[model samples]
Target: MPRFMGFVRMEEGIGMPPQSLFDAMDVYIGEQAAKGVFLDGGGLYGTEDAVNFVVRGGEVSRVDGPYAEGKEVVGGWSIMQFDSLEDAVAEQEKFAQLHAEHWPEVTVVATLRQISDGPEAPGD
Candidate 1:
């Protein structure tokens, strides 16, 4: 099975989505979990306190502000295991629809990839 990382971007100053919407999402996640499809999920805070890290001249620099140059920021994400990309897409579409209704301008991204287990040997 493959895993998907789904991100939900939220509109600026809109606050969190309604509880009912979150409840629906939670229900879907719970159902998936019951069937062993859910790996992990979580909600992120507003980007106001975010700090972006950059490496310059072999040194690290931290910059304040949301890294995205958009009206919305990723307010949350979920990682789920699925049989294929199709399954992940189907699941993500539901969230997309809900988000569209709640945050019309927000972007939704779902990237699917195979989960990799670290090599047994060091630096393998």
Candidate 2:
């Protein structure tokens, strides 16, 4: 089975959602977990609490937020294993629909990407 990452992009300056919305999300996530589709996931804090690192040449530098260029930030992410890309996409659609129906007031964009397996080992 291949793994996919589903992420949520949130527009800058959006406030926390209402408790009712959180409740709905909990139910949806629970269902996914019960179905064994959800492997791991978590939400991130706002850009205000974020730190950006840059490595150029042989030097490393760090920039502290809130970053002005960050108009959109990743709000959350989930890792799921599926038999195919189509299956992963179908699962993501369910999450998108939940947000559309329950968190209409919140600006969120959900996206999915397949996780690469990386290079093979020298000795297998």
Candidate 3:
């Protein structure tokens, strides 16, 4: 199985919602966990909590990000192992739909990154 990292893009100005809504979402995530497909997932604070960095003139400068201009920012992420890209995409679609219903204006990009084994460590 291939591992996937799911980035969740979220809408603007959606401060905390009612407690019940969070509870419902918790249940949904719990269901995923029960299925053994869920590796990890969590939400994030807003853009203010972000930081961006750039390098120039042999110096490193820092700025707040996920790059400001975008309509949606990566609010959180999840890691999962799936059999194929199609399976990962299906999960992304499911998450996108849920995000749409909760935050209609948000846009999402679910990317797939491959992890390969590197050189062995000194021990074994």
Candidate 4:
């Protein structure tokens, strides 16, 4: 089975939503988990808590966040396993729909990406 990561990106200045929103999200996530398709998921703190490391030549430098130029940052993520990309996408659609119905006032963008298996082993 192939694995996929579904992530949410939010624009700058977006803060934590209301308790009702969180409750609704929890119910949706719980339902998905019960189906045995959702592997794991969690939300992240604000971007101010992030750090970026850059390497140039032989020196390494660290850039602290509160990234002013960043238009959006990952807010949360979910990992799931599916038989194919289409199946993964269909699952994501359900998540998106939940957001659409529960948080219609807020703009949320969810994206999905397949997880790579890394380098293959030597010939069998």
Q: Highest lDDT among the candidates is held by which one?
A: 2
RMSD each, Å: 4.6, 3.6, 5.4, 3.4
Tens-digit lDDT string for candidate 1 (33-108):
9998888988887777888899999999898875567676766777788777777778777767766675565455
* Greater-lDDT candidate between 2 and 3: 2
Looking at model 1, residue 11 earns an lDDT score of: 64
lDDT of 3 by residue, 1-124 (tens): 6666777665656566556546656876787778777788787778776787779899999987555576777667887777777777787777665655654543555554444445643122
User: Candidate 1 local accuracy as lDDT?
Assistant: 0.70
Task: At residue 56, give the lDDT of candidate 1.
Answer: 93
Model 3 misses residue 8 by how many Å? 1.2
| Model 1 TM | 0.74
lDDT of 4 by residue, 1-124 (tens): 7878999988867666777778888888888789777899998888887999989998999999989998888889989888778888897888888778777877889999887787753121
* Clash list (residue pairs), candidate 4: none
List lDDT for all candidates, in order. 0.70, 0.84, 0.66, 0.83
In model 1, which regions exceed 4 Å deviation? Answer: 66-69, 101-124
| TM-score for each predicted model, relative to the true structure | 0.74, 0.86, 0.68, 0.85
Show the colliding residue pairs in model 3: 52-63
For model 2, the local distance difference test gives: 0.84
lDDT of 2 by residue, 11-35 (tens): 9777887777688889988988888
